[model samples]
Target: MKAALMYGPNDIRVELTKKPDCPEDGLILKIMAVGLCGSDIRNLTSDSRKGNYPFIYGHEIVGCVDEIGPKQTKYKVGQRLFLFPGTYCMECDNCISGHSENCENEHVAKLAGTGGFAQYIAVGGEKIHYGGIYEIPDHVSYEAASLGEPMTSVFACLENAKIGYPDTLVIIGAGPIGDFMASIAKTRGAKRIIMVDLNAHRLEMAKQFGVDEIIVSKLDNPQFAIDEVLRLTGGKGADKVISATPANATQAQSLHMVKKGGLVVFFGGVPKGSMTELDTNLIHYNNIWIKGHFGASYDQSKRAFALACSDDFPADKFITHILPLDEINHGIELTKTGEAIKVVLHPWDESFYP
Candidate 1:
């Protein structure tokens, strides 16, 4: 098997590697498509997490079951499936409370060593039992199914915020995740959806995804975005605001972009040890709620996968590029330029490989 091994920042090499064996309680998947996520890009560069050196980095995965563990009765070989990027212990306090995303003992894809940037990955042991894998419907393309992981977090955030009719929703980024937030908000009956971003091109692209308004903000003019959001909401501000970009400025501006008593969801994470100063008086005087969200629970993942399979969710439109596995560096560069929305890598597309 050949895999893109990440040695350090801006260093990923595609080379022949030992194929992962099927686990006694799990299975081996031959990766079909894996989405290049923003987090993956971050990890590739400055935001590297503490993990084993030279590990694979992709997580948004859709693959076919190549080999089934003898003890794994839930699925068989030759089945197409989408695997969630994170795993948790079902016996933890958070897991028992239905918040498995925050389980005390949890591991993401890179930490689990089952990254999908390769020909095959071994998934087994307790991960299969906790239900991180789902079958892809025959109608959903492998490229679209690869977005299930990110979509799962979108579902979890919207469910937590409870955005609905007559409520104006404001999203603080125009990237793919922010676009997903806007689209899902429409189905939840949000009266209006406003998107803000620094990239004019991405904002233009977001117009097609049910965005009611777009605000172009500059780093030096954060208040301009808040004022624009207020103007769009008839000076009352939005009922729900989501900071979907990994920038502290957007997260700070989101506080002032919401109406009194409204909720603000911090859906994107900043670098470790980074801090942002927020107005606590806004929370105390205005009765506002600020929630920080991360990954998705198993139930949320299932619902997101089902939504992706449905006709209403435009999964195909979100995919802007598809490249062979060996072109991972080029894919990462495309993502950084804000030129691509979702870049799906086809590991088995040997025709395109050089």
Candidate 2:
């Protein structure tokens, strides 16, 4: 098997490696499509979540079952599956409370020396049952199924904010996360979906994804965008505001864009030591609700997969670039430069892509 091994920050090598054996009560998966995530780039640049050196670093995965171990009755050989990616210990308090995404031992599945970046990887260990694997529906394409992991986080944020029909939902970011948030909000009956970003190209792309309005923020003057949002919302502000970008200013602006008693979801995390100013008076007087969402639980992953399979979700539009495993480094670079919305990797055939 050939795997792309990351030896350290900014260092990755594609080399022949031994394939992993099927774990007891688990399934060995043949890599099909894996999407590059922002977190993966963070590891290569900031080294924030670099767990171990010489490790494979990919989590958004879609693969077919190649080998099924004994007692694995829930799945079979040749069955396509999408991974939840975050392995957890079911005995932890978080897992018992239905928040397995935050389980005490939660980590990328590569700690076991196998990851989606490889040709084949093993899944299902003693404590990996909570959200490790999900079978892809026949109607969903491999590219759409590979997006299951990141889409779960967007669904989780909406759940945290308790978004519902007829609400004016504002998403601050036009990247892949914001794209998913906009589509999900529109399908859930949001009356007016407003997407804000500094990138005009992304805002143009957002128009194709069902957003009611688009605001291209002025890089030097965010206030102009804030005023425009207020104007669109009739001076009351949006019913729900989601800051999906990590910019500190955007996080702060969410408070001003939300209506009285509205819910503002902080969907992205800024770098450590970075701080944003907040007006506590708004929360005290207008009763605003600020919610922070991190990861998605097992149940949320299932819901995201169902949504991806739906006919109206426009799942295919999410994939903007496709490359072979040998060119994963280029995919990662495209993601950082905002040149690609979502990049999918094909481990089997380097030359096949539609």
Candidate 3:
């Protein structure tokens, strides 16, 4: 099968490999759709990691089960499934505490880990234990099902937020993650959700997603935008501000937009050593809560998968481009250049999209 792999920096090669075997209790998946994420681009550029070289980089993945494990319990052949890419060992301390996303065991990721760019890949036992293989509802198309990962991450942040009905929710950045956070905020019954972004086009796109207001930070000045949100909330800034952009600057901006006692969720993946400047007085005097969220819990992935496949909430608008796996470079470039809102890589034939 043909697989797109990362040999090193700026080197994504598509080559043939022996078809992966299905794990004893796992499933062999035929790659259908995978989303190209900002982190994938970051791996190619600013924050590349070592040791994990010659690896497959995709995490937002959806596929149909080709070969089922002989001792299958919940999964079967011919079923479409979503993946919780970060495999975790069930016996670890974190896993015992229901934080399986951080299991210390290497096999947690399994031998045949996230090779979603390939035509076929195997899932591990930890993945299955964590409900990693969620059945894609028959009603959901492959394209939309691929958004499960992003939605799960957004759900994780919201869970950390402890949002209440009619609370004002502010989301920083209008990228896919930001837009997703906005949608999640809306679904949670936020009375006023303000979406902040530098791209006017994205703000316009956010309008289509039903945000209460759109703020172009570079032009409208984000503080002014926050003031408007406070006005909308009767002079008490947003109840919660979720910073979903990787930029450290946006983290500080979230502090400014949230009220004195408001909650702030930093959901973006910032590089190591990145720092955001904040007011020390506010930290000492005000009772604001700044929560940091990382990967999604396995249970959250179930909800996110349901949300992804649901049309009532609607995430089709999130997918702005689709390209064949062989043309993955174009899709990744779209993310780097901000030329595409969301890019779905199709390992299957192109006819499925057009």
Candidate 4:
């Protein structure tokens, strides 16, 4: 087996390793594709020395069950699957309270081990199911399955905000995650969807998925964009404003763009100790709800995987790069630029090694 391991800042190398064997209650996957996530980049360059070196970083994954342990024979030798990389301790107070992702025993995940970057992984326990291992539908592309985590995170945000049909929606950051939120917003019947982002290319990428009404973030009159949003909503502002960008400005922008009694969501992760001040009046006067959604619930994995495998979202459109294991460094570099929407590592790509 071959995999890429992160040693330090801006460094990765391909190495040979023994294939992982399935645990008694687990399965083994032959990784097919994995998407580069913002967190991965953060881990690469985080100021903290907490990151585990010689680590595998990918988490957004799509692959197939190559084999299964005796107890997991229900999953066969050739099932296409998407993994829920989160593993929660079921005995924890939070898990006992049915808040698995919030399990008190589980410390925050700063780095992902056994990453999707490798050619194979031994999948197990709570890490494998809410319902069960998802069998990808024939119609779903590998790229869509790779989006399981990103879409699931967006779904968690929607749940937190309670966004519904006939609501006006404004999304900050037209990045891949933001665009995924827009896709879901439209699917949920949002009355009007306005997307805001700094990248024209990302806005253009959103169009590839058939979204319109994007506001470019680079303008002196950022308020003009908000004004257009207000105008689109008959001057009441949006019912829901989501900041899928990690920037503090994006979150602040969401506050200003939403109407009184509207929901403001931060669906993207801000680093540790990062802080921002908001006008307290908005909370008191407008009755606005400021909500932050972190990772997805372990209990939602089965449903998320099904949705990840569903035909509804054209998730394949999200993948912009697919490289072999040895070229994984290139994949990471591509994702570093705002331009590469999604980059997947294919350990099996023959060109990577030769």
The candidate that achieves the highest TM-score relative to the unseen native structure: 1
Question: Candidate 4 — which residues are off by over 4 angstroms?
Answer: 21-25, 47-51, 67-74, 89-98, 107-114, 125-132, 219-228, 231-234, 352-354
Clashes of 3: 0
Per-model TM-score versus the true fold: 0.94, 0.89, 0.88, 0.86
Candidate 4's error at 122, in angstroms?
1.9
- Which candidate leads in lDDT? 1
Give Cα distance to truth, residue 323, candidate 1, Å.
0.8
Each candidate's number of clashing pairs is 0, 0, 0, 0
- Candidate 3 ranges with C-alpha deviation above 4 Å: 69-74, 88-113, 219-235, 350-354
lDDT of 1 at 307: 92
The RMSD (Cα, Å) of candidate 2 is: 2.7
Task: Give the per-residue lDDT digits (tens) of candidate 4, residues 1-354.
Answer: 888777887777789877887788888888887777777877766633465677777787778888888877467888887766666666778878766667565433221234677899887643554332456777777767778877777776676677678887888887778777777777777766788877777787786654657877655665666777777778888888888777776776677788898888877777788886677887789999887777666666556666767777776667777767677666666665666777766778766421
Model 1, residue 16: distance off in Å is 1.4
Model 3 TM-score on a 0 to 1 scale: 0.88
Residue 222 in model 2: lDDT: 77
State the displacement of the C-alpha of residue 199, model 2, in Å, after optimal TM-score superposition: 0.7
lDDT tens digits by residue: candidate 1, 27-54: 8999999999888888888627455688
Residue 243, candidate 2: C-alpha displacement in angstroms: 0.5
Give the lowest summed-lDDT range of ten residues in model 2. 105-114
Count backbone overlaps in model 1. 0
